[model samples]
Target: DAGVTQSPTHLIKTRGQHVTLRCSPISGHKSVSWYQQVLGQGPQFIFQYYEKEERGRGNFPDRFSARQFPNYSSELNVNALLLGDSALYLCASSFSERPPYFGPGTRLTVL
Candidate 1:
């Protein structure tokens, strides 16, 4: 199965640099979610956008933002990166009320 696909599987950025991560959901899926997973911790939800509208958001700073496109793909943007931002960025796709299918995720390192 094609499943979900994410770009730039690995990334390196200096503190204060901004980054944009991309995700393509499985076909027919209308809900996309973004999550951040730090070392030794479970994935923390960042945002969930469904049907091109913001559905939910987690406890993150304003520097984090995301959008879902008409095609159901999504992009997660983070500005003014901090060392603590180093983690794995995960993308999940699913039907509006079903369990999600997660992508391999993008690993980011902030120096």
Candidate 2:
């Protein structure tokens, strides 16, 4: 069974630009969540979608958004990004709302 996968292993951008990160959850899973991990800190949850509905959201700003599709794949969009947004964007999946298995993440770098 394939595990969670993320696109563009690395990314670079400038301030105020928009970015979208993609993810595919484990086969047969229905929950997809997004998290942001800075240089020296743990991941901070962003958004979670199950059965294509918004289930939960973290303390992230409106600039951070995500959605899950029928196939359990998901996308995370960050609008008007800031330098502080430069971090690893992780995608996680779970069979239920419990703990999730994570992806390697898309390393985002902003200048």
Candidate 3:
């Protein structure tokens, strides 16, 4: 009964590079979502996947994308990374649209 898990706890990349983040949901969960948290600010929703389909997305640009697996795991990808992309990427999972349990997050640093 894990909450949520994200890999590569931290990452470093240069501007214009691409990075991928991974997430595994809790047992019995069917929905997974991604969020970005800049230092000193609240997390901003990025994407929501339910049953391996996208259910919602935030105001992020096309550089941000994500997909969920049949097993309820998910991956978040960012293209053309910018210094502004440095943030904590969080993964959340739940049974429905309600509040979801979040993972520790992957810290992305764009140099």
TM-score of each: 0.98, 0.97, 0.97
Check candidate 3 and list the clashing pairs.
Answer: none
Question: Which residue pairs in candidate 2 have backbone atoms (N, alpha carbon, C) closer than 3 angstroms, thus clashing?
Answer: none
- Candidate 1 vs candidate 3: the lDDT winner is 1
Model 3 stretches with alpha carbons more than 4 Å out: none
Model 3: per-residue lDDT, tens digit, 9-110?
A: 999999999999999999989999999999999999999999999999999999999999889899999999999999999999998767899999999999
lDDT of 1 by residue, 56-100 (tens): 999999999999999999999999999999999999999879999
lDDT of 2 by residue, 29-55 (tens): 899999999999999999999999999
Q: Which ten residues in a row have the lowest lDDT in candidate 2?
A: 63-72
Full candidate order by lDDT, most accurate first: 1, 3, 2
Q: What clash count goes with each model?
A: 0, 0, 0
The lDDT for every candidate, in the order shown, is: 0.97, 0.93, 0.96
**Model 2: CA > 4 A from native:** none
Pitting candidate 2 against candidate 3, the one with the higher lDDT is 3
